[model samples]
Target: IRYSVVAGGFHEGEISCMDICIQRPIIATLSKEDSSIRVWNYDSGECELVKSYHSLQKEFQNTNQTYLQSVALHPSGFYMAVSFIDRVKVYHLMQNEIREYRSLDIKNCHSLKFSTGGQYLACID
Candidate 1:
């Protein structure tokens, strides 16, 4: 097998965690250094979405400090889960945008993964 670079120079900081969707050419990535989540279309070499934890905290009126941990894309490419130091949040992906779907109060979650069938989300604290 061979490998090549598809996209570059998009992330300003080191990517701490990432996951790819099984049903689509979508990749979900988290950069702890920037406290942001980015969704990329690997095939088109395009960044579909970028979300900052600071913005989310402001939107939700959360004032506590926290850091990003991990990101996971659903097998169907319809959902993304992001784990943070204080909690885990699930987002719905649509039209290159992410909407808040649900929040899991799993504190200090360091890892996240969706089941192969996309029926369950597993996390490690």
Candidate 2:
């Protein structure tokens, strides 16, 4: 019932493509104008930007008009998940880098959710 929301810069004329971790303190998103995914820090009102959500894109998925379709957080909060048009990627919060441990390709992954227990990830392709 209590929270702090911080706003960040975005791609020109680009809408926010993201999903919230309900009841959690993190958010994930992408912007075509910026060509990146941004993971926001939402605790203690630190007002910090954990940029480098996703820095690289494959040739076919790279475009100036990309939009993140979905996002989720591992139950443990040690990791975060982001979904794109052609892939799904996870990140390690502490390392501030991609996990490089897993990725899913099914195209147009519009939504994703992590089981409360963190047992499995449900991604809608």
Candidate 3:
């Protein structure tokens, strides 16, 4: 079987990384070139949310040194963590919206993953 997602005009830059939620039919993609994250409902091939790092945090703007590295969706499908050059930001998913929940000051974080039980998040610097 093949799953085709209509993400033609959504991500302007090449997608750097992506992750699927274990508890939901959802997918999250990251575009390092544009510092953006897009959440999608894979079951219906719909784009649920599109948010740029620069828009969520001011420090991300006007700085070419910072770029998105990776993204991880929680097992419960209620949270997401995005890694950047200097830090990792966690967001809460609710009502088709994403809100910043917390952040970690980990430099050169290239990967992120949530535990199978959703009890912890691991970052590889």
Candidate 4:
């Protein structure tokens, strides 16, 4: 089955790519070229969360701004891993909030994925 969602938001730039949560089929995640990530419910076509680059960088003390190279949602729908210029970050989604879960110091991360069982996260630089 295919579902279409029109996320409601004002974007300074266009979206780069998108991914869906495997366990929660109704949830979708989108990454913007401007280094923002948004999570929404496809079933409702409403944006549930928005994380700007500035807000996300504040968590890691990243003085140098970076764009999101890729994003991947965990199978369980509770986690997301994203690749930036010099690091990979995992985020936890809970009760409409997004928070930094873990950080990996890796340069030029190009892609990310969660293991089928959601026990492991992998990134390719």
Worst 10 residues of 4 by lDDT: 25-34
Clashing pairs in 2: 32-66
Q: lDDT value for candidate 1?
A: 0.84
| lDDT for model 2 | 0.62
Q: Is candidate 1 or candidate 4 better by lDDT?
A: 1
lDDT by residue (1-125, candidate 4, tens digit) is: 99754667645667676778877754544454455777887777777887778665555554554467788898989888888877888889876788999998988877787889989878776
Separately for all candidates shown, the number of backbone clashes (residues 3 or more apart, or on different chains) is 0, 1, 0, 0
In model 1, which runs have C-alpha deviations exceeding 4 angstroms? 1-9, 55-66
lDDT of 2 at 22: 57
Residue 117 lDDT in candidate 3: 96
lDDT per residue (tens digit) for residues 74-118 in model 3: 998889998877788999988668999998898888899999999
lDDT over C-alpha atoms for residue 84 of model 2: 72
Which tens-of-lDDT digit does each residue in 9-49 have in candidate 1?
46678888989998999898888767788899888987888
Give per-residue lDDT, candidate 4, residue 56: 52
For model 4 the local lDDT of residue 54 reads 63
**In model 2, what is the error at residue 125, expressed in angstroms?**
2.7
Determine which window of 10 residues in candidate 2 has minimal summed lDDT.
45-54
Total clashing pairs in model 3:
0
